[model samples]
Target: MQDFNGQIAFITGGASGAGLGQAQVFGRAGARIVIADVRAEAIETALAALAGEGITAHGIVLDIMDREAYARAADEVEQVFGAPPTLLFNTAGVNSFGPVEKTTYADFDWIVGVNLGGVINGMVTFVPRMIAAGKPGHIVTVSSMGGLQGSAIAAPYSAAKAAVVNLMESYRAGLAQYGIGVSVVCPANIKTNIAEASRLRPAQFAGSGYVENEASIASLHSIHAHGMEPIELAEHVKAAIEQNQLYVIPYPEAKEQLRRHYDEIVDAVLPMEADPEGARKRTEALRNWAADRARVFQKSEG
Candidate 1:
């Protein structure tokens, strides 16, 4: 929506990084901010920072992987704000890097739980409420540039983020009927602390933490420390939300990378003879199958 004035924004991972950036921008635009994060100390700091700027903000300690906790947080948001949030941000995420074969199951769980599960939990908990409110709203899920391409070292992170991209596409198609806009942000590197995500790994996943790749980790940290400012990315997100844009990519180089990746996939597909009749028959069969399986979303605006 063009107007964010008086809207309530519920942002996961809002304590820091890109989420915090969004809070800053949306708050300046007159939206009440709700910062949900697992780190209690960080939440305190973020809330204070917002308060210093005269932005109305609330903080809730949240671990997005816990579905019960998410439900409670939603209740708390409504309790505090007197209504459900209209702007939802599924931006909480973490990163880990290692050889694919060497990565442990715990690694998969930890990475997937925070990156992909966080987005799913946010959608499951908030989308229905936003729908019921029958007000214009928007959902933004932060994937990554890596999600658009594969990486040998960060396979788990890439896989989880890639799934987020696909999930948001489905939500966009379904939620459009209700006028709830959806945007999947695939941002490139930015100045954030995500490189140090291993610090918060649960005890259960300790053994699966980043392998002995200090040099690589150091290189990545250096890049992230000097990357684009969060406020710049925040500006892009604001514009995207205003325009109801589906994809938000702030980095210039990422476009070329996406092009190459998609080009490779397109080139790799096996070619067959062009047959209009055969294609029409296949299309009809697909439609029948979708109808039979109840795989299509059918909803009409009132």
Candidate 2:
């Protein structure tokens, strides 16, 4: 997994933002790159940027939510590269903000489908292939700081990202035995076009039309103006992959926030009751759960 030279990388959302940053960095490391995005023009522009730098890369117009399309894209990638990608980045995402009461079904579906469902699709489409190839590989899925902490204004987005964080952790435990390392990236604000994601929502998922809140959009943009550059974050991702780290947290303050969140969860657990029999039974049950999980892993790796 540490090796990047001559490897193949399949990156979603690579038209811009962090995905594009990864393509640039990985391409420089001599990895063959496949940049996939729903926006054709953006993909063209991204490929052109890489081409200008003399990086070996190509683009595929992709919508990760489409299962059939994702399968076809996987096929296309193998045909182009002569093998499946050794690196898979499920980095595409979108968001919408409002009170939970104001959040429509369409809004929830759109945000969740792209942010969480897309990652699920990528994992399902690629993991089996990677395992069958019997090669060392890594998977990195980009969640957000908001995933660790819920946001009232962006409930659906936060919920979806949180799910991705948990999903990746589970995948990490199961895939480690198969030589497929998994990492979930929980990044804070970065200079990206996520605030404008609603504009790119496909018509099929646009249930209720979203009216952009200019003031909030402006505020988000202002904050992003001072955020970390995408390339710097991408470098951190590279280091995390090389080290086989589970979590790629770029913002320094995020560690404190996460600690506080964990502390609150710990505090919520009530003191154990003075019942030895109950405690013994609970311990046995938990032991059984762990054993079951271990057995599943062994069965897969056997």
Give candidate 2's TM-score. Answer: 0.93
Residue range with the least summed lDDT across 10 consecutive positions in model 2: 205-214
Candidate 2 lDDT score relative to the true structure: 0.90
Runs of candidate 2 with Cα error greater than 4 angstroms are 207-216, 273-276, 289-302
Candidate 1 deviant stretches above 4 angstroms: 212-218, 270-277, 290-302
What lDDT would candidate 1 get against the real structure?
A: 0.90
lDDT tens readout by residue for model 2, 12-110: 999998899999999998899999999999999999999998888879999999999999999999999899999999999988777877788898889
Per-residue lDDT value at 282 in model 2: 93
TM-score of each candidate structure, all chains considered together: 0.93, 0.93
